[model samples]
Target: MSTPKPATEATIRANRAVRDALPFDDTTDIENADRGLIVRATGQILTDEGDVAWDFDRWSFLDGEAPDTVNPSLWRQSQLVSKAGIYQVADGIYQARGFDLSVQSYIRGEKGWIVVDPSISVEPTKRGYDLVCEHVEDLPVTAVIHTHSHIDHYGGVRALVTDEAVASGDVRIIAPVDFLEESVSENVMLGNAMARRKAYMYGEIVGYGPDRAVGAGLGQVTSAGTVTLIPPTDIISETGTELTVDGVRIVFQHTPGAEAPAELCFYLPDHKALCGAEIVTHTMHNLYTLRGAKIRDSLIWSKHLHEMLQLFGDAEVLFSSHHWPTWGNAELRDLIASQRDTYRYLHDETVRLANKGLTPVEIGEQVNLPDALAQKFSSRGYYGSTNHNVKSTYVYYLGWFDANPANLHPLEPTDSAPRYVEYMGGADAVLERARDDFEKGNYRWVAEVLNHVIFADPENTAARELQADTFEQLGYQAENGTWRNFYLTGAMELRDGIRKQHVLVTASADSVRAMSVSMFLDYIAMRLKAPEAVGLSAKFAVVLPDIDERYVLELGNGVLNHHPGTADDVEATLTFDRSVLDGVVLGTTDIAEAVERGDVSVEGDAHTVRSFVQLLEKFEFWFDIVTP
Candidate 1:
């Protein structure tokens, strides 16, 4: 494998100019980040197996100024989130930062502590909780509040509270309505595909270094540990719902569809601290996350910010799930309003441009942030940039269509590439021309033209090498961390190909068990091979005796449909535990073994059962990307 290249002179010039463009001399964010005195981790956070879960020591290179290879603005943002310790945001509120992508907060109640949004995994949150006990107070947790449905906010729940504790009413698990459905079903439904995309989005394999992995705009990195989830006991549905748990008066503002599908914000009346719940972070949050999930509602997100200010404008301190807290009412409100207006601007301008017959890509190129917003460090595109957000906003209203006949119904890349290459004087001519463009600091165009040759003939080693080099330079110049990660990771893959070891863990036993029977069936139906199942007709009456529910699975004309209640004249009647099907999907328990052991009992047409199983496709987890 070839070594990574140094930043080109063009990249160096671009990075140098970032210092002058942004107010790097101002130390307000630096001052605010280091406001509270606390002990940094300064060592490895090791699990029981002596394996390191999080290593601040590895990322210690972030302690100083930005290098020429990195975007100065992003480096500054990374430094703020890289600080690890227990910080006292207010009198009774404390936060554990830098353990993972998301931070966990501890609110001291009259009885014990109420933990908010634990980090992504067990070891990190456990480390965070231990820090709370050692540094803040040694109090048993009274409650665990999940501010949103994202796993990063609530996945490490078992670390703070157990099932017995929650069951016995010793601890209360609180969250927004439909939290379980949102967190488990949606994430697990597309687990494999999203896991692959996640690798590129975060550049997880592209670990910490001076030239790489400088924080993802949200935080330093995600933790590699066990992810677990527990259902919520208390659900907040409507806005302005007040709950006094252990003598702490908290007002919950339900912000569904703002960031995550199910999310909420809470304000402490006594402490005057408002938890934004990933709604407003230190940087511009993603309206359209590159991991290929649903598009977030920027209008609703801005409205929620407006509502937060109206409800908690007097908040002395404002903290979010990611990044550090903002102190003082003025500063906190300004941050909220700035982020709010940023989205509003994206929404309004995109729609305005579309009405004038402009498309998403065209509008994206034209939209510009006002000097006031562009100058603010918080409003910079360290995570979410105006360019992509404009496209997201336009698609939110007008969809992906650009209204041009040439754009609509275009040929797929694979089919069109050879034709494009032929028209451009073949592979050699394109590569020769692209090399000249690359030398001229025109990497964007070089990458575009070189891709046609790669797609036309993937065996073209010359094309792959040039494209990889182009992608590396683009990554070096990117200010947005996700964009940089995607570019750099793609470049690495082009050079060395995909390595399967770093796959993200998207589903677990806890999350799978939380899914409804219907939700699981829905995913199974999606996995049916339409080509294999064409002209096939079968029906299975699935009786889950443990859950005491009956479901009908009907297959016809290449479509698998699930219906509730009994179906007349079914091909076979099957009775088994839901666990059996889950095991089959997760590759834990074989269908044949379950049948042999009498775990699954078939009433009639056993041959149909075998045939139906054959039709269900096992998804390929390591499907190709950056290639056909």
Candidate 2:
């Protein structure tokens, strides 16, 4: 129960100027609401103990006009997305939005319903499915379509239908090429760090308020529950791929390295609808997400948008994995065209500036969209701002090196902060100057200067308080939800210290089971304690009887390598079912206990397995971020 600081006069005036500049009177978004009508609306969906998994009413502040602390444009978008429940997108297509981070669509087919992008978790997906069932006839799901590799797009598959049903050939799971590989390995490698940053990016640690978490631009917030993944039975490998599930016809268009590493859009010929998935959402997407991943290819993203215009321009209605649907051929086309131009403009202009010998920071400060692209509600920076996107573009093409020898190898933050403080005439002098800047409404500069003081001497209470106050002002002014969350979360950590609570990384047991053997090996490699494994040289053979897979594991020079094959000369050979292996990896059961329970068999020597296990370090989820 921390109280947020009130917005200053400067911040209020800035927000008002933003309000006056935008087309607040534009009613097209409201008018577009007519395309779909909500069938049912509820506040929250609870588990057996009355724990809330999905709460649509948390964002009720958006019902009125934007507050002084929030961007008016973002408020409008939040209001639009806050409308929860099942909606009819078209004759055959229905959508369930506001239940999770992404929408779940149901297309009525000849035999049953075809579900698209079943959201992030089991509880919300099941709730959405029940709502769909209430509106339409009770129909079995014939097919499930996953548009991309992101967890929000495909994590809730098991909630819709069982794996048993999919295995029995009663239902089909469809996704783009490399979907399983991308889905399993995408977050697993950098999962701990990414999950920590994701908590800040999504405002999961912050409470909801006018000054705190309001909306995530894409949705209210990510739902917390069991995340499950069912591997796709049919992979859409190429553009113009056609599939007819039940009676509905779909034309898939692959658009990788756009919004996601593996993504596709589908055009419905019968319903005259296009499922643009995450590629074409209401807000401008991240070329580089704040939660840390490889920078996306903006050039390829723009190209895909143009391709979508060419492939599905005739469609009269459009629905995305997030946000509401857009109707009318002319309107849908305009929306797509505007989004296309936004990315193209960002990419081309960023490159142009870079070629002119400007650094990424300079380019970010210099580049501004033309009024044409800027005025479009769909192209607004409520999710991804131009400042960061410009840097992402530069890094995607040129990488982190900027051809500056001085910056090629710079001192780390901790090493440089004390030197910076000394050069600025010590922490007291730096704090005095930062306070002057803070008073002049130069909060950004204040944050920059005071950060050095805080890092140089973390026990300086005055510097910490000043830095937190500066970040509060910056958070109040941010239009992008993630930016606001990051700033505010940083401020919260500064004031109250890092939270010790555990954050869930994986969503469900199904996702754990769906992991490939290679992915498991990668996870183990990350956990290997370098100091402990320094002089250890060991070899082992792992046999998974259930999946009929064998791997030879070698450990040397503080590194572990796993390759497909059986090593009969290994020091130890372990045989177990894949499920038992999964249980050990996921910490559901101990390896020694499993061996005692006859779930795992050890041949040759059991001491090697114990020695290897002892060298692995388990990561603590709640690691410090803002502070050292």
Candidate 3:
């Protein structure tokens, strides 16, 4: 048997040539108005894990357009994620960037640190803390302020402080009212599906390399670490709430519906410093995140930013969780105004195009960032592209329709995939043409063609490999971290196929221990198999031993409703502590085993509740995609 030829330099060079021929950035423009001063340029620091490479100069490209800047918003967002490590924005306030996605914290009372947002992960968060500790005297964390409910903004909480601090009342956790509920509901209820989509949306599936990763544009990538939920000791329930932590006075401005559902900004009267959280970041934030969520209100977002401008017009230092800090009143004001107006433009033009009877696609095409707004680095869409944001803005105001009756009923993906492939010609013919285009470095065309092939028959290795190669080239050429991750992740999926891994399958002892009785019932409600419950009627009363709260759950017509108080009649009454329920959710034990082990007690008709468990579906922890 003859062995296949090894991958030669010629083959490597051939791949290299394709990557080289593709359009990519060829210039560096770091000459921001506040360069080397307010936004210090310390170049780049390698991640401690050494899993990824960082390039600062290449990221701050603004002098050129087109491929050099994948999207203006993306470029500006990358600036925040990849900016310098540390700088003194005010006398007592400091920001540590590049330590991980714009981690900014406030130094208070000589020995205590009041952290605003810790980076994206524990490692980088610790790295940032070390950097801060090196410059100033290391301080114990007296308080933590979570500005919003995004993973990157608060994922590093464990690194900054511990629950011991909270228990001892040495440290206080503060967040906007409803922040905890919103965060828990969003992350936990849909964690499995959201995690899968996030693997694509954030490019976590792809390896970090020149052709595989730049970052997710928000940050390099979220680090895998402990996720702890410490309840807020104090919630910012109202706008303009005044509070002081460790001798640092803060005036809070609640900006709901601007970014996260419950988000706020705070200004320090003494230092004249401001923390925008994710609300008014350096780049255009998502009107709709790719992973999935309710569409954000851009109109409300813009109005809130405008309010911030008036509220903190005299703020000397402005910092945020996802980007570098801006110092000086004039520069800070300009940054705020530019971001505020950009959202306004996106919202107004989208509505304007919609009023003209333009479809979503047409509306997106008709809208463009005004030159002035486009030129400003802060207004660019490093994380959120203009095209997507335009469509998102329309979607926010108008529902998912163009008022075109033709689109009223559309073919689903499975029905359309094979038809598209057949119309374009058979697999062999399409593959030959795509391979030729790949050789010609027309990756965009190659990708477009292979998409049909894969959708039609995802198991075709030849088609998958060809498409993977094309996506790799695009990933390599992409300047935006999010774009790079998108392309690279697509390539990885094409090559290795999708993996059905659930990160939340194994719950942390802390997250489980911290789980509340109400929260447990909510989790079970989310697990209800809607289809199975359809046309079925059942009622069960559940009792928590410690809390002494009686709850009734009604399942009928594919809906599960929970009542805090007792119901008139329940078919079965089940009694168990919260820990036993956590074990069930974590898949550590069967319902019967818990009952057998005396961990749970059944009262009344136990068989009815047991029968309900049969209706519940257990999702697979892993699935074989490539073989399938």
Candidate 4:
């Protein structure tokens, strides 16, 4: 196994210039982060059993000067996000920061506290609220505002409010329209694969350190705790939707198709504050998240920000779910304008270049944020890189194909690796030249060539080690935290095998039950083994009595098709509550137990459903990456 190395001379010089170019004199963010700190946490948050779930103490290392192993700009951002505490944002507004990847805000209402975008997990969010009670006022949660459908924004719903409370109207859950569908589908259908990629994205394999996971650019990292969800009671459908919850007149600006598929920002007219949610954060957010998702519309993103100015330009304070708040109307407008311009530049220039026959990769390579926009700290590539954002913009309009016939039919990495290696004078010859380039700080070229050698021969020790070293250098130089994590985690996997033995990110039990019967059936369709179904046909009626819905499942031509209501000549009619099915699928109740316990009943020959189950394949989450 190889060890992580220090920054090379070339990397050090480049990083030094970055430090010089950025505005170090500006301390507005630093002041805002510490402005309302009640008690700066210097300890750990514990679970029910007194076991540590989140340790604020360990990240105290961020107080030190930037190391050679980290981008100074990222280090600065990390330090700002590392300040964990309960802070007063205004006379009635409070924020609990650094408990998780997202901030949880509390707006003092006439009756009780209205929580906004609770953190990622139960323990942390519960702890954050408890702290608020101890330091501030102890009040019941009147409402929960899920500003978006992202997991980090609303996964902690059950921590603050329950389904019973929501049902009784004692606790009102607010979210954008399509929040439930987006939240459930995003976490369930592609859960395992996205979760695996998210491990690298969040630097889970690589622990936090000066040289390792400094920050997420927006925040430090996610809470490794129990995730929960409760459906929203009040859905904001259109822009200009106003809700006067406990005396705070909140005006909503629906920003769907911008950041999350369902996202919105709100303004407190009385407080003169605007909660930007995840749409407008301290850094440029991912246009296309590496964990896998549909490409976000940058054009729409810019439009929303422009709309924010028109609607909430007079907002005295601008608070977001991730980073610290910006005070003063002037600074708030300026920040919004800069963020707006930065994304607009990415959208416009990428399209302009694509029209001139530049491919996505070509455009990404040449495109740079103008100095006017790049100088602003918020517009910097701390989370989302300008390069990747540019590429994503091109793909957003045109799509994955670059229009070149050769590119359109390019060979898969495995299929072409051996030939590429053979053409490049074999493995040893390539490694010999790669070593020279690595010494000369040509890490990117070395990485590209070495990947072919690695794919051609996984057991080649020299090639793997060189690739690991190459990735480490790239990680050290990356300003984007996600990029750093991907590079370093890839390096770690090359040196040591994948860390798949750990807990995987999956949809919660509540999420599973909350999913519409149609969506759950869609997930079932994804699990169908196409090859097993080929030339074999099966039909079944999935009857969910709880939802008063029946869906017909059909398997033919290696594809599983499904729809609402009944179908003619179905082989089996499987009747079960959505709850019982959730328990069975989540492995809490086995199929035998469910049948014996009378949780699920079947008619019209159970053999059809049994054979259909056999045709479905269980996904193995621990598949290879950075290897064949």
Candidate 5:
């Protein structure tokens, strides 16, 4: 409940770098220019229930102490993202802002439109479609283009194209060649872990407000709306594969290495417009997304941008998935070039430092953007900062070892915590010193010291409270909304432990149903408690009635080894389509009921399959995390 001490030299230096990396002026100007544009584009001015600022305000980070928790930098970002309604980026192109991420659609030559990157939710994507229709002549949607393989970018496919339309072949869904594969890998393969990490990354447990929900800096926020994924009808395979849909010529330039593994930016020849997809956004996207992934290749990312520059150098209008569009060829060129150089600088410099045998931390300290690139507004880090990107570049090439043998076999958390406390004289001495430092406003140091104390004894409320206070003050000082949200959220978690009851709908049945049998079995493997499943050897062959396939799973020594083809000697054979499995997972239909209802049919040893299912642990969707 006490504020931490002053910022340390390192903290101050990092903040300065963060400021230099992402200047706030760009957002200010964009907000001013697009203010009226957003308001006018929305046909129904429903109560600003859809404001990004309202949904992700930072006030909730402060909780009860609303005034003190407000961070100026976060407030500014929220103001820009929350400035209300849809916006007109260009003639025939309108975007629904603040609803969820930013949905932008382009009108084709005929009395039809092509929706580019629908909002995260069905309701918002529908709203965006309606907003465009309200302004322009209402027309049939000819195509839905998914720029990349992110949930927010393509989750709203259903809103634009109904099931009937898709089934009837009236609507064409276009995307990169490996879009579906990449989407599954990123969002589903490790979905549970990613979902958990995303909760922390977006501060999902904390209520939305000025002090709490500034966002991950990509956009206003992610919508947990109906997520529907229909496989792409048209896939752009070649580099310059052009698609002429509804009289609009779209030249797709695939950028696989950068951003998502399967992402492409397209050039509109007719309009001289370039849709950068999620590659070169208004803000610096994460090379190492906090939600977790393989560290992105900054070098490859920069190279892709360089290629885009040559491909769309004369593009007069530049638009992205998140933020306002850039008008004029001059600004477009400048923005693209600057962002390209930003990544190049991080990549080249990080490698330079790494080649010199500097460790990741050491490289982080030394790596910085040149003054020219750092000063550019677009080069600034809003979504992804230079510091983290530098670390990412380092890790991507060198791995986490850092070439230090001493660090190779470092003490684990449990062993190190007590040693740290003892080395610092004692728990009381460390707490006293940290408290004194806190009074001096050295919040970073206070948090660091108290973190050791808590690790020493997690039950120590005083240490936890002090550390939480330290995090709050640091959060209050952050310029980047993500940093502020992360710090403040950390403080809240420390103070109130976890709040699992605040669970958001992570994956719907639609998403789960799309999962391949291999993915499902992988998830089951992950869910198995090693200790509980230990010493139990079980083999079962699961056959799908609807789909012509059977999977053999061997559970032995707490490891679930899968043989997709089949195992003749397997003890049990369970048969069902993907939907039946989904029904069981969603708790809509119990296994017994499913069998009785003919949704699921079991042949061979049913008891073995039942035993395996019983041994599988189901995670509580809404556990009381804040409670001790």
Candidate 6:
């Protein structure tokens, strides 16, 4: 284990300044913390070999006073979120926190319990469910409500209830409209890239310490286990949708394109509690997540927060998928209002700056939360920083193009770096200048210049060391956990080179099984090597007798198209169960082997099918980032 460098004087002063500015005397958070009495606690969720997945002990540093290496405001928030266990939210409502990236809520009904957002993986979800059963009466899960399409919310469905129970109508699996499609598809297309980025975003690869991985600002960290998904039996499509599960009345408020592409907030009218989902977390949620996804609409996100306040203002308590519940009608309303203002301000101010001819970087530098929103802990940028959110806001409206023709078609990094280094008097000269900037605490500029030097000549060990040191300083000062992790991870990669580890790029077995044939085809289309498939044309018909769906696939002009119904005029016709295709896609079974085993039937030419399969490019999960 390597000991991290101590915080610099500048970083220590900055942390102290933040601590001095915040209202540390406020006891509201403490009061709210006390309300949720713990029923059970497990600090670590381990695998069969005792390998830790999600460890609360990693954040035990939060128990003490803030160290000079950590931002005090973030440390305070970490301490609050570090409280992990099953806790009573209300008379009939309970929640399991610290089990995963998201919380699992259990609403006690007349006969059974309604499970809401069952965490990220099977092991933690099962443990949480068992804890709930121990505290409350052991009852079958009557219904499972997935508030949004995010994996952390609904990926653990199989642990609490079986697909057979849902299929047989013995249990209800409820979710937002398009939940099944969005949940599976969101992470599939660019999943390998996202999974790699997620390691940095969640600090999964980084060790836990005060100077390392403290907390994700949402939860401790993501739980690693078998991620599962069960298709929803009930879809809440429209706003004002009402459902009663085991005599508990619930009203759904659809907030799609707010936090997620498919998301909803629900009000338990009988209990006077509102489940805000991920839409309204305790910390400022991301408008554009660091792990690369579609840019979220900040305007629409703000609008939905206002909508939640308007629709469920009367509710006395508010609970979200990540954090502890807020009690009292006044406090809940205030929390919603603050979060609403945070997004709205980011949106309006960013556009205001962009209209004045400012670029994304310029806007990011200029925008800051108003004093009212900034003062509140709920609106602080613990997860999503104001700098990135402002840039995301600019991108949401104008996009990557800054309208500057100079940047319209820039040279690739490799092509551009050599020239940049030459212009800056070669690699040594650039490093000398960067070292000066590093000494002056101009880490950002040092990083920018050193990047060109590294790309120009990767063997420049001095430039790499200086750049890594600069990143360490920046990481030490970052209040946002993701930002801190990204910097640290980049530095580690620069110093030690890329760590060879097998990252989980593919979706879980259950999630793959739930994917429709059309969805699977879409994934295949994405993986097609355009260069290999160029000018090559082929047509194939796929018949899944089990699902009773037939699709005609056409590959031509570097594009793969699929449509419902089969055609007689085709190169080949393949018939098989959906599971066989799933196995092939997941790389568990070879297509030729399945065909040889007679599991897959081919009525026409098989060479064309093999050719098409050969054209698909398998993604390398550990592709380098922050380097050439």
TM-score leader: 1
Q: Please tell me which model should have the higher lDDT, number 4 or number 5.
A: 4
lDDT of 6 by residue, 159-267 (tens): 8998688889889988999998888887776777888999888777767788787777877678887688888888898989998888999999999997899998899
lDDT of each: 0.86, 0.84, 0.68, 0.86, 0.70, 0.84
Candidate ordering by TM-score (highest first): 1, 4, 6, 2, 5, 3
Question: What C-alpha lDDT, on a 0 to 100 scale, does residue 431 get in candidate 6?
Answer: 80
Q: Residue-wise lDDT of candidate 4 within 1-628, one digit each (tens)?
A: 3457778887887678889999988988899989988866557777666656677877878877789888888889989988899999998999999898899999999988999998877888998999998899999999999999998888877889887898999999999999999998888888878888888887877777877778778788777777788989899998899999977899999999988999999999999999999888899988988878889989899999999999999999999999999999999999899899888999999999999999998999998988988888899888888999999889889989988898878888888999999999999999999999999999999999999998999999999998998898888888898889999889989988876644437577877877877776777777778887786787888888887989898878878888898987888788888787686446565554565566778788676566666676666677777999
Question: lDDT, candidate 2, residue 62?
Answer: 72
Error of 3 at 344 (Å): 0.9
Question: Candidate 3: minimum summed lDDT over ten consecutive residues — where?
Answer: 1-10
Candidate 1: where is the Cα deviation over 4 Å?
Answer: 47-51, 590-598
Instruction: After the best TM-score superposition of candidate 1, give how far the Cα of residue 314 lies from its true spot, in angstroms.
Output: 1.0
Task: Give candidate 3's total backbone clashes.
Answer: 10
For candidate 3, write residues 1-628 as lDDT tens digits: 1111122233355444434543334222244323434334444434444533233453444333323213333433443455555666667777666655446575665458888876555655666677677776577788889898766566667878877889888998888988766766666566666666666666665544333444566565555544455677889978789998888788999988877898888998898888888877656777887767778888899898899988879998788776566777898898888888898898888998888888788877778788788765556566676777889888887789877888989886557777888987889889998988877768778887787788788778899888777776665555445666777676676666574442322133444555666776777767778887786687888888776878888988877788787876888777887778767666676676676666778777766666666666565534433223
TM values, all candidates: 0.98, 0.96, 0.83, 0.96, 0.88, 0.96
Deviating ranges (above 4 Å) for candidate 2: 501-504, 589-609
lDDT of 1 by residue, 1-628 (tens): 4577898888888888888888888888888888774667767776676666777777778767788778888888888888888888889998898888998998999999999998888899998899889987899999999998988988788898999999999999999999999998667888888888888888876655766667788987777777889989999999999999877999999999978999999999999999999989878888888877888888999999999999999999998899889999899999999999998888888888999998888888899999889999888888888998889888888788888999889999999999999999999999999998888889989988988899899889999999999998888888899988888888878888877764447687788888888888887788788888886798889999988999899888988788789987898998998888778656687676677678899999988787776677767776777766
Which of the two candidates, 1 or 2, achieves a greater TM-score against the reference? 1
Q: Looking at candidate 5, what is the lDDT of residue 257?
A: 73
Q: Which lDDT tens digits does candidate 5 get at residues 1-628?
A: 2223344554455455554444555554454437437344322322234423224233234322123344334444555555545566666666666667664656565648888887666766776677667755578788889888778877777878876887788888888888877776676555666777666667666656554656656675666556677888899877899988777788999888789888888988888888888877666678898767888998888898899988889888888877667788888888888888888888888888888888878877787678787666456566688778888888888788887899999987668988999999989999899988977878777877787788788888888878877786777566555666677667777776676643334465666766777877786787677887787787888887678877888988988988678877878777788777776555565666666666667777776666666666666543322222
The sequence of per-residue lDDT tens digits that candidate 2 reaches over residues 392-458 is 9999989888889998999987889999999989998998889888878899888888888887888
